[model samples]
Target: MPRPEALVRRAAAAALEETGARGAITVLLADDAAVKRLNGRHRAKAKPTNVLSFPAEAPGYLGDVAVALGVVRREARGAGRRTADHLAHLVAHGALHLAGYDHLAAGEARRMERAEARIMRRLGRPNPWRGAT
Candidate 1:
């Protein structure tokens, strides 16, 4: 398998292509503590999440995405998914968010899910929404 950074970049690139988002994005693979700190500082959440997206305003830059290794591994184990696959899914999900996708409403969620599924398919990953690993 590819290194974590390589996998993340590949997934993010695929998501950007799928969303037609232009500009550059930075993907960070971090530990739980670092992610938790970011989550608290930015979102007022005290816990670590699998992934977080930070959109940027500067030209030619979409945003930054941070993924928590611990959270992703736990989630993958619990969901019976490969850690790499889950990581890819979360990375794509974050990239989509950077591209203005959200799941705050049913319609928005469906659209995002479809886009994510398509991106995953293009990456040769399974449909994460259906729990297909």
Candidate 2:
């Protein structure tokens, strides 16, 4: 597998291609505390999450994707997945969000999951929701 940073860039590019979206996305690898602060400030949630996406307000700009290193590592270990693989999944998820995909509803979530699976597969990564119920 490629390095974590490479995987992130690959995943983001794949997601953009999968969604036929234009522009570029900025990826930020941050610690848990920083992510927690961002989550609290922007999302009104005072906890660290795996990933967060801030879509660009202007046209021709994709958006920003932030990943919490500590949280991601912990979650990947708990799930028995490789760190790079998990990071790729998170990057893809955030990129999809930038492409205007949402999982707020069941139907929307299913669609998003399917899209993510396809994108990950194209990147030579495993299906993130393979065993999901």
Candidate 3:
């Protein structure tokens, strides 16, 4: 497998292509504490999550995606997936969010998951939600 950073970049690119997002997106590999702060400040969640997507305000810019290393590692272990694979999934998920996909509704979730599956498959990764309930 490629290095983690490489996997992340490739996944982001694939997601952008799938969603037809123009311009650029920033990827931040952050620690739990940093992510926790961001989550609290931006989302009011007061906890670190595996990934967070901040969509750009303008049309030409895609936005930013942040992943917490520690949280992601723990989640990947719990999910019985490789760290790189999990990271790739998160990157794709974030990109999808930047492209205006959301799971706030059931139908929207299904659509987003389908897009994720397709993007991951194209990146030669396994379906992240294969056994998800």
Candidate 4:
């Protein structure tokens, strides 16, 4: 909606604050092509996802977050949510990952989801996993 970069930075800052994580984070707001390339190169996933996080090794640097603008827009349209809200969710999700949160297991998923819900609520947005089983 407004400036995607500003939205991402604000959302990320909120997430990092909520998680008590301190560091400088970088976020890339790009089209599907750039996200797809990064996904393929880093994760071996050929398709573009809504967001991806790459942790940094340098001190005082948290990590890099990449979001596919097209993908996020499509998902927001499908979910009946505003693009800006959806962007905040994805950025928070990526920031959580940068903060060492994961959902590879069922228990881990529950933990991560709870954290995400808290972040979304703090942002005055709905929980992104409201309908999930």
Candidate 5:
């Protein structure tokens, strides 16, 4: 199996292809405290989220994506998926955000979901959104 960074890079390449993003993107697998601080500072959520996206202000360039590793592990266990699979999905979701897709609107949500499903299918994994039951 590949290292975490390798997995992330492969996932990033897949995400870029899936989203048609034209530039580089960063991925950070962070610990709980680190992600919690980011969650609080960036989103004002006061708690860590599984993933966060900081899109670039530039054209054709997406910015950094951070995933809370502990949160992802817990979520993956709860969802009955491997940790790597969950991590890949979160990265894909962040990449979609970088591609300027939003879930705040119904049409946008559907579009994003389709993009996510396509990416997940390519990854040979089940759709995380579909497992919402």
Candidate 6:
């Protein structure tokens, strides 16, 4: 398997290709409460999820990708996958969204899922949406 950090960064890069982002992205691993605060403050979701992205105003910088450690562990357990793999995928997905990959529609959803699958395959992780277990 790939090293955890490398996999996460690579996934982020893979996601950025479609996001049109031109700047360095900072990836931070935070706890659930921290993620919840960010989610509530930024997204008004009130609950902590797996990952969140912050878009920077500066040119050539995509801002930051934050993954909640607690949620990641919980998600990994639910998916029966390694925590690193799950974290890496969420990190990439968050970065992609920050870069502007939206899955609010069917076509866009398929494209995003395809991008995620390709990146995860390249990183030696299973496609989370495959439903094949």
How far off is residue 62 in model 3, in Å? 1.2
| lDDT (C-alpha) at residue 100 in model 5 | 82
Candidate 4 stretches greater than 4 Å from native: none
Please tell me which model should have the higher lDDT, number 1 or number 5.
1
Please, what are the lDDT tens digits per residue for candidate 1 over residues 10-122?
Answer: 89999999988899999999999999999999999999999999999999999999999999999999998999989999999999999999999999999999998998899
TM-score for candidate 3, residues paired by index: 0.94
Q: Put down candidate 3 lDDT per residue, 86-128, tens digits, no spaces.
A: 8999999998899889999999999999999999999999999
RMSD in Å for model 3? 1.5
Model 4, residue 98: distance off in Å is 0.6
TM-score of each: 0.95, 0.95, 0.94, 0.94, 0.91, 0.87
Model 5 score (lDDT):
0.85
Candidate 5 per-residue C-alpha lDDT over 22-50 given as tens digits, one digit per residue, 9 for 90 to 100: 99888988998899999999888889899
For model 2, residues 1-133, the per-residue Cα lDDT tens digits are: 3457778889999999999999989999999999999999999999999999999988789899999999989998998898888899999999999999999999999999999999889998889899866
Q: Candidate 4 on 57-90: residue-level lDDT in tens?
A: 9999999999999999999998788999899999
lDDT of 3 at 107: 100
Candidate 6 segments whose C-alpha is farther than 4 A from its true place: 1-4, 17-21
RMSD of each: 1.8, 1.4, 1.5, 1.1, 1.8, 2.6
Better of 2 and 4 by TM-score: 2
Clashing pairs in 1: none
What is the model-wide C-alpha lDDT for candidate 2?
A: 0.92
Ranked by lDDT, top first: 1, 2, 4, 3, 5, 6
* Cα deviation of 30, candidate 5, in Å: 0.2
lDDT of 4: 0.91
Q: What's the lDDT for residue 4 in model 1?
A: 86
CA lDDT of each prediction against the hidden true structure: 0.93, 0.92, 0.91, 0.91, 0.85, 0.82
